[model samples]
Target: MAILKLSAAERRRISAFFTCLVLALVAWVITVLSSSYNYTVKEIITFKNAPLKRAFHSLQSDTVNITVKGTGWQMLLSKIREANHQIKIDLSPLDYEDFVVVSSQLPAINAEKAIHNQIIAITPDTLYFDFTNRSVRRVPVRLIKSIKYMPQFTQSGLSIIKPAYVTISGPSNLIDKIDVWHTDSLVLKNINEDVTTALNLRVPAEGNISVYPKTVQVTIPVEEYTEKTLELPVKLIGNVDYYNVKLFPQKVKVTFTTSLNRYADIDEELFEAQADLNLWRTYGISTLPVKVVRMPAFCKLVSVEPGNVDFIVKR
Candidate 1:
């Protein structure tokens, strides 16, 4: 096998040709970077150092459309670092009922260098904002939670929320109408054990209002329950008129299930079983359905014996 090697003169010529190509590429890049170009960019506008006693009720815009002119390199760098750009407007000098027309106050580049870019135009050359007197109010926080317990277990008491109330500050017109703030919805299924968790409070969609302490702790108590039986007397409802009505088996067996702590509080008086006589008189029926009128809230009514009772009327 034979290897071909370049002679000294051929090597020098090849090297010169490559060097010229490299120089030409560098010159082209420098020319492109030095040329000026115009760019349109969007920047967020924020309020800073606002007065403690004043609130902004409305703002015409939260962003500005800016057209800038700079060297191509500067524009490229600006686009890459645009995320750090923000135009802050100070509101400390404003008073209630005062309106401010805001203009662009361009930010420095790279935290040290003054931006060489000229702001050709700002779409909203002037921005407007309305100010109002700030008002503070204490509003109750309502927890929004849905819980389902496992069979044989139930909620023993009222669900509690820590920091039941929150403070809200905003324009008087907006704060005066807000009476309650609600937490985000929390759902727990097959929850046999007590639940304690932190939940975020819902923020009003309106930009004029702000709520303090954006979260609250919620606790739902759960307990094991036992079944109980009670014998409750049945009563007649509606007037019997001239007829004397008598129902067979005037008492019913009421079976219910309640939490162990509330088992002792269960009594026959907390339940009412009644038969309506108006239906008997209206339809001349000898048998009437017995209905349980009232029951304890914490107890689940399991069964009522003899759903229908025979009745006899005598004039």
Candidate 2:
């Protein structure tokens, strides 16, 4: 075989091709080592109560850190934004453990360096609820209906057909200090006849309580009758100084014509006949209010004819 020497141009061309290939390979290796990728994570989170569920729903703690490794180009393309990155966790799977919560699993990352990598650690907060049973108690009854009296005279006293009381149930701690509930108010402005009314009951102001038998039967006794033809002098009983009331008609002339049996129980005191000017005087009111005078309990006012008498007052 005859040996032949290669041309210089041919050798140079071959060397150049090999060098270009090596440089390209080196660039690719650098890109792979410098890049990073994204890994996904799933963890179980829990809260003490229903209200606190939102706080730990997202992995929102600095304590949790995720790190991934991959080609530099891939890592640059991947994003680890806090708002976009999320961990899947279930709360219902939790068992009663402690007021403070611990995640069942650490967040798994979707990122990778292709080998073992750290995802993220998660921390959760817990909330608690208290439940208990309470006993029964009695509360006051409040009337809801409105009443109007005759123009000349007003109600002297409020009579109840039956006493008012209600039973309530609630938390044990709150029920202990409570004795009875007081109703708001019952105002009978200008009623002058026998009236039968039903009243409603209400709880005290700003109270957290559960009442038994939500509704109750309330009866208000009302009646209107003429005064007796017989002139009966007015007599006052009970300490008036407490109410600050002044009696103007120190004595009223009650005139009534009735059977001896009907008149037997009639008296000034029995009829609750007296001027309740006590409240009025406190506010500096001078006009005397027209009201029934003292009379027998059994004798009802039939017709006074004149009804109210004019009296002179100093104070």
Candidate 3:
């Protein structure tokens, strides 16, 4: 009791010493508190080297669980996206092997209390994604024209080009599956002498393939009938010169392929061939415009025996 009583200076020195000890104790507590925490370590995720287009579609899901540990304060401060937070882990660089995934130290984050540092589980919905290789290729495209047939005419007659095949190259996986592609179709009406038509080409339903050259030539077969005499209609193609005059045979001998069904109701009056006499006069030529006056509409002009004749007129 006697020693407890001290001078003012002694009391002041003892008080300062106590204060310093208390401060040191407080500092130690704070350091310990900050170091201990409950963190969650979540599951591991796997990713493959997929095509760019397909990879973009895989990130639609939200909320991945990762486990962490630390003190309540430290854990609470841990957030998914802090200035130093790491929200996701990449597994692309790792080789495939059987091993347990461990928690990787990340930056401080503010986590919800509910997420109290605990070992969490994580998983993905899809696995084994297919990587597509997209490439451009040159494919042989044939024209397949769509035609409407007359009522009650159920493709009575039709002809297609032989060896209907084209070469196309693209991605190995995509091109390998295509054995053959088809064009649309060509339809016809009744009472037709002979008609030539074009068709367009298209890809099969199961393929997403594209062709480089978008178009190819296709000729539709025409069926013709026999005709003893058919009128050749005159066709005025190019404009006649001011001083030139054209003359037509006025009639043509028509012969068709021997088919009764083909000749029926056929229009053979739309063909005509005329010789220009004005051209001969202008050139001061004696033998000019010596072509046949006309030929049958159904008959294709093979060769004009005497393509020209001598028509002389004094200029």
Candidate 4:
């Protein structure tokens, strides 16, 4: 490595040159920011202090494009600020109309006074909104969930929702059409145990519609299932005139699977197995298929021994 030393005058000149360069860069930035420029931006419009008895339904527009002229710094700050430009329209003094113009009802903008941005023009300066009579109703809430249980597991009882219903307040037309509200779709696969979760309800984009309880708690009861077998008598259906009908197997073994809590509640009498004799009389078929006429709701029929049985008729 070689060391080079500079004279005092040369070091001073180098230092002054870099300082001037930095100053020039700062000056350029200041000039660009201070200069006035025109820019177009989107502003969201929101209403406040709406009448309790009346609801503001369909709005002609929720946003408007406004052209503003101000310094570059002012424009940049406005774009980066977190505050939203809102226009409040007092509805207490206004009468009910099919549509109302918002420009005339718009209150003065006091929040933007500090920004010092001149509003050149606002597109669709005349805003319009549809008004309707407000109404409230209590509607049931339904849970939307896709659930699958593992092997040997089944839902024991009905699924319960903490708050079975919700209150909705909106336009009379919209409220009359809504009978129920549903939660967001949820999926649970291979669930072996009970599940409880809180889910949000579906929210409409319409500004006039509103739900009192936005979220609800759902509980799914699951239990282990056991297989049970029962010997049920097979009755002969239809009339057998002048002929004695005898099935090879008088009784059938009805195998079913149900939750443990409901296993003892099931019995052979709950199920009805019968073979139709009309088929044999009409078609002269010796073998007839046995069908289960009734069964418990909680019990799932697995199989029926000797699904088809032969009948012998002799006088």
Candidate 5:
């Protein structure tokens, strides 16, 4: 094929013609998008202002289509946000009536709408509910955590949560099954010292359940650990027959790591090592596994010098 080349002056004219075409196309889009248009969006319903005396559950699908008039730009953004947003419906009227009008809450819904958009109608404009005995219960907050501690450091005690219990109010059938409310995951990395933070309560997927005080304060006690070793006398356990038995090694060394604050106080008295005699009585084994039955909650057991003890039973 032969190559075709253009002069500088011809190239300039060609580029300007193409640029004008692009400009005209862009101008058309701006005008079209600026025009008012009506669009429909499906928004999940979030019930608020629930009735105090009655427990209610939505009888119909939780989703509703909202018809709104807005500029094309607003309609475009609303479509992008449809899956991420919800409309709040007041259920306070459910105290006396079984239904709520969605249009009645338009003022509240309009406040949360995107700029330059107006909601005209909500499909299934009336919300219906089924009633049951209302219930309010207090349940403990279970902390969900993802924590990594620095080497030689660990939690000293149970994490403390302010307002350890959250009040759950809903239909008895629903809240009754919930024993403990879990918090959103609290993540900490390479933590060497005590941590104090707040955690949000995980939202219940059920629309009827409500939790007051959305967040709880959490304090996890962390401290650097120090190793301690002690020789503890082994006591024979599971000796129901009280057979005359003796362990070859009556004592075993216990190695554990404890917080510096408790290292000085954690002694042999705080720990008890026992050898299970059930192995000798039931299975007729000569060796019993040595286990520490009691230890301070803050200590992490490392190892026992003699993991098993040899026992002899005499008639």
Candidate 6:
């Protein structure tokens, strides 16, 4: 191996040269990235101000290619944001004309671009629509839920939704097909307390179908549950053959869980323990299955003690 020794002055010159090279590279990058440029991006098309008297179905597609003019900085961010964004166009013009020019909406579209980006042109610059008879109807809202409750906690009563119905307007054929509008799934996890929240209705799949009051208020009552047990008198049923029949066990212990608020009001009167005598006539079995046929509302049945009882029949 060979080593090259340099003087102090030589070392200083080498350091200065390297420093100038690095500075020059950074300045070049900044100048290039700051300059203005033009680019193209794809965007989804949406409509605003649809006419009420005339139901319309767009004949053109729901997409467009937008040519944008902006600095280098906007070119980097526009592509990412454009994918999630839709360019809304005014449909009021469709009242008189069947087609619309995208150039007319450039000013309004550019106003929302905060990155100094301007829309230059859009492919398929004209939008066209087909007309049909319009119809309107009011339909009830059916809420969908995917919820989980903590141990011994559950929903106490029916969920309440404000403005129970939503109005839908669209082509006559489409309007007739829709019956009830459904809300987006209301999801909750390990919920122990009452819930009051706003939920959005499902988005219309067709371009012309419109729903009013897209959002609804939902309230669900939640409560912790406690166990209750009662000795209910067992009744016999299905002895139509007129044979004297008797069951050894006349009562059963019914165990169930109910909300804390309803625990006091729940009693044996609300429960029904039954033993069917059809077993003795049809299957000729000595044991009859005892079942709880009725119970209080919002109560969960845990078990029925003495599930089977011995029975004797005299013909």
What are the Cα lDDT values of the candidates? 0.79, 0.46, 0.44, 0.79, 0.87, 0.88
lDDT of 2 by residue, 168-279 (tens): 6656667677776544355667765555544445553322255555445444544444444544444333335454334545555555533333444554445544444443
lDDT for model 1 comes to 0.79
Position 275, candidate 1: lDDT: 91
Residue-level lDDT of model 6, residues 1-315, one tens digit each, is 899999999999999999999999989877877888878888888889889899999887788989888777678777675656678888888888888888898898778655467889999898888988999999999999999999989998889998899999999999999999999999899999999999999999998999999999999999999999999888999989877877777788888999998889988878898988887778988789998888766999999888988877888
Candidate 2 deviant stretches above 4 angstroms = 1-127, 130-133, 140-146, 152-163, 182-199, 203-208, 228-315
lDDT, model 1, position 42 = 84
TM-score leader = 5
Put down candidate 1 lDDT per residue, 1-315, tens digits, no spaces: 999899999999999999999999999999998999998888776666566677775456677777878888888899675555666655544654364444434442123224667766666765556766789999999988878889888787788988999999888988998899999999889988888999999977766677889999999888999999998888998755857878888888888889898888888879999999898779877788888899987888888888888888777
> Tens digit of lDDT per residue, candidate 3, span 117-188?
544333332223223454443433444455544432222244444335565544457766666556665544
Against the true structure, candidate 1 reaches a TM-score of 0.70
TM-score each candidate: 0.70, 0.32, 0.28, 0.73, 0.80, 0.78
Q: In candidate 2, how many Å is residue 214 off?
A: 1.9
Cα deviation of 296, candidate 1, in Å: 2.9
* RMSD in angstroms between candidate 2 and the native structure over all alpha carbons: 19.4
Every model: Cα RMSD to truth: 5.4, 19.4, 23.4, 5.0, 4.6, 4.1
Please give the TM-score that candidate 5 achieves against the real structure. 0.80
Tally clashing residue pairs in candidate 2. 52
**Steric clash count of candidate 1:** 0
